[model samples]
Target chain A: MKGTLIKTVLIGISLGLIWYTNSHLDIYNLSIVNNIGIFAILALSYNLINGVAGQFSLEPNGFVAIGAYMTAIFIIPMDTKIDMYALMDPAPVILQMQANFPIALLAGGLTSALMAFLLSVPVFRVRGDYLAIVTLGFGFIIRIFAMNSPAYTNGAMGLNDIPEFADFRWIGSITIFTFMVMIHVIYSKYGRAMKAIRDDEDAAVAMGVNTFKVKTYAFMTSAFFEGIGGGLLASFLSTIAPDQFTFLLTFYLLIIIVLGGLGSMTGTLVSAIVIGFGLEWLRFLDDNMNIFGYETGAHPGMRMVVFSILLIITMLFARRGLFGDRELSDILKSKRASKRKDA
Target chain B: MSKGILKIENITMQFGGVTAIDNLSFEVQKKEIYGLIGPNGAGKTTIFNIITGNYHPTKGEIIFGDETITGTKPNLVVQKGIARTFQNIRLFKSMSVLDNILIGFHNQSHYSYLEAIFRLPRYFGQEKKIKAEAMAILDEFDLTSFADHKATDLSYGNQRKVEIARAVATNPSLLLLDEPAAGMNPSETEDLSTIIHKIKQDFDLTILLIEHDMKFVNNMCDLVTVLDYGEKIFDGKPADAIVNEKVITAYLGDFTHA
Candidate 1:
């Protein structure tokens, strides 16, 4: 108990420092940092199922789209004109007063959670690759539905003029809270049950675990956070389009978890920050590069190419991933002992 | 006579015209070590599976403590105070031995997901109490030293002990152990017999076991049932069961040596 408190305090202090720096930094750097924090939450949400809970689900993008659209519908002033195109009718009288950033984000999360609950009833019945296919289909269905819903979502034209609900301050606070909550959960008895189910379903059932119920609970909880992440992304950009929530986004989240290691919360945290910011940094290579005597000016698909190479390398050499199921505290403890020996 | 805790009547389990347990009927009394002994392919394990709710009886009624448990989910059967260990050791390979036992306490633990998330007072209280209880159970089997090790890393005898530890952790009124001494040295088999007796006394449990070891069965069981070709040939006291002509014939094939 004391150890947990000390850990929580240290995390609170570190988060406070990051929030202060982000708020005071230059605009360009602030945007990058903010995005890194937001994506960290998104990737961590994905990790709840893929890493900790041991179910490979490819529906982060679907939940994100739900969050984004819900946030837009709730927060974006319906009366606001978008490029001379009046997107939605004027805000309802009740909503005009109730439309706040936090409330909208909460609604987004709740909406996604409800969707996940409904979807998991059928989807979680299957295992392994079949489960992946079901989740992938869900993402496509969500995107296609968003594309076709012109009245509510503005169709392919997209919803714009959304209020900026997630700046550096909001993302940083929420990310820290989410990360702590995830860590607490993974260390709990419920987390042990989840891993037991993942390791051996039959054995887990014999041990009195209702594997189906555990899987569904994990799925819905993950979807809730993914929804919050989606809302943050939409609020940051002030616009949302169906194309943004694609398989590619889910692919990125998967890469984050793999780079971190499955079933490792600390691994997810480190990988999320590194990959989130690292991808942004690598964008420079896409725009300016010289190959032998030729100038490769910002190759269009450089990010994907670099990511694919990194993934292959990681899989081949470091299959356990960066943290390999160990948390940051575990790494720190091991490092401290080694440093003490060296000293 | 003590009331029967588990009653299975006219149970017939079939697989594509092959009857595994045909018209099987039995009742296990409270606090008795009931042994089910049968030759190879005589369907002893199949009966255990049926009683534990793994396989639905084609036509039978299973009443446990006055409630029908046939065709119930395995986890619900466990929650209803019926626990079992498999013939093959089925410990969660990656989990610590202690955690494996804690998993048996899943239905008993009252902490909610929220309580766990926040590490609430109740969560800590329940966890600490359960951990202590789990350690005590391990201590009973002399498994405290190996509690932190992965269950799969244990030796065959130790693994068997761990499996039993996990089963009894559910605090069940009735326990089913399938071939508890199947592959063990004489010393290990003797130790397992002692542990089984100790556990039944300590937990006040009614145990039903399937074992092929004749010496172990005659020594440990109060009453024994002998099965041949999925048919019960004898059901009586272990001494009587050993002397029954049908059981001797089933065991020694003609009973000339017996």
Candidate 2:
């Protein structure tokens, strides 16, 4: 009952935040708000696998791509199906089918999860950097499949004309839903078992934890949310291509989680928002570096250089990331206890 | 004529060309505190490996409670009422003491992942039950105060205690303590002996212990066996095993030649 109450209140607050931002902010800022919602889902899901589960996965981009393409296929308007497939032939069933935005988004997420399930069977045999290697390979494979499977994915031309059915409200609701489920799972016995596996696999196994099963479950679930996040991005951007879901995109998520402090949920939220906006706002650096209105000339990758410098500074100073495996609620709880003692 | 709860029948564990445990055999009776002792690399741990399903013996079988358990997985072994601590401490370093213990009850947990994710009534109900039960176990081990502390943050003695507490929380009928008193001070070892005795009686558990702490082994174990070079050198009463020439020579090299 308490969990449900807290969840409803959070959803209400998120909805209000989205509505307020939409009405009050300028177009550019509103778009940032949308990016924030999408990034929250992506980063939080990634955190479940990397931070909380301690799996060190680097394949969220592939999962996200699966979701984006699947969702784009469903949400593509009926009239554009022939034109969309003109570059390559879509399946006969795909041409005849049309799903609502919500169903399409759900299918997109499930597709990513399905792929994760298959990938996990082999990947679970390896741990540490080996797991990362296999997962990275999995991501590359997905992207390559998207590139070559022109009959389905339109090759490199990518999917356009995707319906923008989801707005700020939809994103907010999904974010809240995703956050609530992940939080509950984190606090449960299932989550504890995952953490135990993370801390020491042998110990966890001796303690009766099915480490392989738990690891696979965590990876698959994380992939599910990554897919949803990518689906949302597709609708928000009204376009997506194979190039958009690269290893660099995975690196961007890693930065968010690292800056947020790996296992901390609120930290992920804060860092995702901070970095998401920072990425867009820093585009001025790429356009033409200006300090006191002195142009240093345009450099296409200058923004990335500055971003890399900031990440280096963060690593040098705050190696454990912002919250260092702790959440804001932990600090609040301590403060409340201290105040009570003083009183 | 009395039977044993566990029977290791001609178990030979060979790794590559080297036979770690060469045709070893032993039996542990129900509710008996049995001790296995040896010098380093005598295949005492190798015997443990065979029992814990870390190795499928090259030949022979392990019969526990009338069931053959020669090649079970570690997780399944725990579910079959067998739990063990490591020779080296292996607590989940990043988790709280409570979580470390709570996870030991993974096989006992009734709620599904779906229920846990949704926080359904069954989830909260099981969580509360497990929490209360874990707290009770912590209190018994004098670990309740450190329940919220990380497993690695505890003192060395407390970490060992936490590992044992976590193992016991699995509700095993047979508990294996692999060098449980390895790094403890005298007082800690003294306390551990008492804890082992108390748990054996209170939980109706049979214990198989591997310890170099002779005093602790003599005090707590009902039967003691000595192993040297992968072969059972002595098996009898603790007093008899301790006084046996082979057991003595195994620990201290023979001076008769010199």
Candidate 3:
């Protein structure tokens, strides 16, 4: 009951902030906030498969690409589709289809989920480094497939003019809902079964848990959320390209989850928001400068260099991330106990 | 004269050219504690593996309570009312003791994932019941104090008991214990023997255990089967099993040719 109260109050505060930002903030600032919300969803979903399930899978980029393309294809206006695919003849059935925002999002999630389910049959047969390699290879394959297929994805030029349905409210509400569902799952029996498989697969099987089936369920759910987050990103940006969904995108989410803490939902949320906003905040590092009239000039990838250093420092100092698999609730309870004792 | 709860019929397991178990057969009656005693590499654990579907027999079938369960996967085998512990403790080392036991109830949960995520009535209702049942098991076994500790935090004897407690939580009709008293001291071994016998009565379970300890086999087992290199050498009451020449030769080595 107490937890429910805390959750509701926190959600209300977030909604109030989102409403205020949507009304008063500039478009650029609003986009950064939206990025934080979207990245939080992506990182949370990634953590489910990689951290909580202990699969160490690197397939989020592939699933996210599926969502981006699926949303772009289904929601782009018929006239916009004709302009986008004019270089090559547009695919007949998918051309000019204008789905509502929710339908497009659902379609993207379901299609990505289907792809993940099919991939799991072959992919889950291998584990650890081999699974990582296969998934990494699959991520590249998705991008390359998009690049070569002009009809569906408009080849290299990519699709633009996507509908902007994912504003502050949509992103904020979905972020809260996704975050809540994941937390609920972590405390559920199915979540226990997933953790059991993570701890010991053979023992979980011996304990009457269907290790394969439970893992498949987790993998599919993770894909569903990643797809939805990806679609949200595309809709919010009003543009998307094959290059947008790369292994680098997967790496960014990975860094956030690692910096936050594996198996910690709150840690992922905080770290994703910090890194998401930090990326935008640090973009001045890439700007050409005449600092002190020296003409220092723009450094193309300076932001990433600093980001990589930050990640290395974090790995060295806090190897288990900020939370170390313990939650805020655990820390808060301990603090309250210590305060009572002091009194 | 009565049909057994578990019947291993002509179980033969081969790994390449080598046969781990060759034409081995045994019967464990209901509500009885059966002992499978064998020399090292005699395929005792192999039999357990076959019965629990970790491995399938090359040349025969396992019938548990009238159903022929030959090559069913390990998870379904447990759901079919059979559960087991490993030769070396295989508890989830990072999880709490209570969590380890609660996982044993994984198949027993009837709530859907939606129900769990939404915290539906069935979710809370079932979870409360499961938690109560798990706590009762802990209390009954005097493990209530260690319930919050990591499973690996316990002493070796306590770990062994916790494994049995977890297996029992699965609510199985037949329990397979692989070397339960493996590293126990004499007192611990005696305690385990007493507990096994008592659990057989209390849980209404058919227990088939592999033990190297002759004292445990002699004291706790209602019926004993002796294996020499995956072949059944003796099967009878412990009193007769100890004196049987073939059983003696299997353990003491054959000197007739010399």
lDDT of 1 by residue, B85-150 (tens): 999888877677988888888877788988887778988888888899999999999999888677
Off by more than 4 A, model 2:
A1-7, A126-128, A289-294, A334-343, B1-3
Query: Can you list each candidate's DockQ?
Result: 0.64, 0.86, 0.73
The collision pairs in model 2 are none
lDDT of 3 by residue, A1-343 (tens): 6867988899899889888888899988888888999989899999888888888889889988888888877888888788778558888877856688899998999988998888788877655566678779889999999999888788988889998888988888889888888888877778888888888888888999987777887888899999998899889888888898888889989999999998788999999888888887898999887878788789988999999999999999999898766568756865786687699
Per residue, candidate 2 scores C-alpha lDDT tens digits across B112-187 of 8889877788987888898899999898888888887778989999999999999999999999999999989999
Candidate 3's displacement at residue A160, Å, is 1.0
Q: Over the stretch A1-343, how does candidate 2's per-residue lDDT look in tens digits?
A: 7857976887788788878876788877777778888988999999999998898889898999999988888889767977876666787777766788889898999999998898888888766677798889988999999899888888898888888876787887787788877888888888888888878888888888888889888988899999999889898889889999999989999999999988888889889888988889888878866789998888998888998998999899999788877678775875786687699
lDDT of each: 0.84, 0.87, 0.87
Q: Which structure among the candidates has the greatest DockQ?
A: 2
- The residue ranges of model 3 lying beyond 4 angstroms of the native Cα positions read A125-133, A281-298, A330-343, B243-245, B252-258
RMSD in angstroms, all models? 3.3, 1.9, 2.8
